[model samples]
Target chain A: MNVEQVRSAVLKLSVHNDAVLSEQGPHCPGSETLDIRHFGGEESIVRPAVTDMHFPEVVFPTSRVGRVAGLEKVRELVVEHHRLIWHSPLQPIFGGNEKHFWKAVELTADFHAEVCGGPKLYSERKGHPHLRERHFPFTIREKDRELWLDLYVQALRNVAFPLEVAEEYWRWVESLSIRMINRRTTFAEPVRVPFNHIAERLA
Target chain B: MNVEQVRSAVLKLSVHNDAVLSEQGPHCPGSETLDIRHFGGEESIVRPAVTDMHFPEVVFPTSRVGRVAGLEKVRELVVEHHRLIWHSPLQPIFGGNEKHFWKAVELTADFHAEVCGGPKLYSERKGHPHLRERHFPFTIREKDRELWLDLYVQALRNVAFPLEVAEEYWRWVESLSIRMINRRTTFAEPVRVPFNHIAERLA
Candidate 1:
């Protein structure tokens, strides 16, 4: 197992743990660990017994491939991505508008997960996930999509899934999200200010 | 999950990805997402059909649980935790480390998963996981563990697992890894440093 795969196993264990709520996999160090007596003696080496994270492989759905793409992976990404966007040293500057920034983060995170191979609630449960239908509600202008895509690309890079995988995935997502823009109505209305694309920013 | 579980998952996924080599498990999106196509062309939103990353869950022996602990909450933590860690910038760094670090990350990840309640590799195969025995082959010093744990804990915080759970999990992990340090027979021992306890690093 690669590091990510083992991580995937640990995550899957948590999925199995849905009801019980412990993480009896690697990094845990086990319960015998709870018994401090093993440590006090001379040269005594103790390996703690895992209390409860492992489980039947039956617990997980069969489609998640690699260390990178599971529902569990998505949830983990969602939480972390949100934390970075909403809680970082720079995020507070958004101040009273923090919710908007987070909403955008959530939006991008969902879109990014789909790109990286995570589950999709908005798209799946609902249908076509009309990015426009959903995002149409936002004041998403071209600048917004560009900015959104910018943060999104960063998140994708931050996640660092395999390059080809990410390329194949984001190539579609970045383009597809364009479907969500209100197009004629939003863009034609004219007040939307534009910003540089990712390439431009880098240049 | 509470951050302890998140930390565990990240620890596991961020490391150990290269260990077993073959890709296994965690397949399929929810059934609701199967086989649909992009609808509006420009607005193309489709069902969550299978991506390459998606895999069906693989079944493993229940006996594997003996190695790891924390059986109480495996369902949610396993896949979920890895999801977050897999995305972290640290993942690439860990993947790039030497074999020793690679193995250490895998073992510790196994340790975390077991502690929080997932699998059991340590006990099933190695009996006690004699940390010193397993580690003596390498030049592991206290500083090594400290640096390792630092990166580990940083990954956890970056993922934003709840602080209390994070701290508890960290304490347990930190407490355990300390035992892995074997005296250096070939080099002068670095001065023992004060504990860099991470009790206060919370979001």
Candidate 2:
């Protein structure tokens, strides 16, 4: 067969499932500066890189919730956490507009579902999560990260998550939260809410 | 100790390598539409999912070049191929400006090295290659894809890539070229150049 024919035939086989354009801003005249207007189109969301359960939260106990509640609980928990953020002072910082905030809630639900050992919803839908890049646009200060962690802790408590499940999930979010800190003032204040504030609710 | 204090201690363990933002365009008033100017900052590049070798090029002979020349050869091969594209009629379509052109060349080299079983430069620097999304801004018709493939074949001839290496690499390019095609008229026309035109140069 003519090599061109062969090459043409080969070209036909390249069927890709998804194609994601680079999130880095385009190189126009005023490209270097972080212009929110130009960056408005694509809200670069990425998957979390760190999945390991850490510390006290790492010592996870077997939970009946995951076996029974599964992804449904994940969605509910994420929605609850988002609702708290939505009403809190940090809402705008965390979620730019109402549409963006709701999108974040959906993405978080996908993340929780995937990371909690359920379906690979996030990766399959969104490709790998570049969490830092996704959060780069926001001025994620130390307090913001802590408040985020607090909301998750509160959400877990409110939902009555199994101790093992709650701690394990917290470990992931807590660590993941620190990386989100792109800005911070002097005096790196610690989290105001107790880490296991949800634990008391269980009792 | 207070649960919050102890939890704070646990929170200390949240370590992450990096977090990337979602690349999907922002949901601004007119964000949904694909505007090349808006997509201008970064020269969008992505990975091809269909990696299978195909057709007469299917029987890939083992290349002594990759074993002997290794990554150095990959760099040369990619650079040479990019140069051909740079000087050719296809230059503007592939690389809009000098800066973007060089960037494309660099990215292409990175991709070549990684797929040739060398260092994972592309993946490390650019995450997964969402080939389709990268090419989304350009109106890639069938002719464009074919011309791209032709350039590769010619480049291989110019560089005198080992028979096995040339064919093997061609299989990849031929397949990859198809994914870059975002537009085409009915009944895709055959390449203007003869198949194995590069092969004729071998004699």
- Candidate achieving the largest TM-score: 2
* Residue lDDT tens for model 2, A80-135: 88888888756656534688679868987876665554566676766555454355
As a TM-score, model 1 comes out at 0.26
lDDT of 1 by residue, A39-67 (tens): 22222233432221111111111222223
How well does candidate 1 score on lDDT at residue B194?
Answer: 26
User: Could you report the DockQ of all the candidates, in the order they appear?
Assistant: 0.03, 0.04
Residue B147 lDDT, candidate 1, scale 0-100: 63
lDDT tens string, model 1, B50-130? Answer: 211111111112222322323333323333444444554324323334564546545555654544444555445444443
- Cα DockQ of the candidate 1 complex: 0.03
Indicate the residue-level lDDT of B86 in model 1: 50
Give residue B201's error in model 1 in angstroms.
2.5
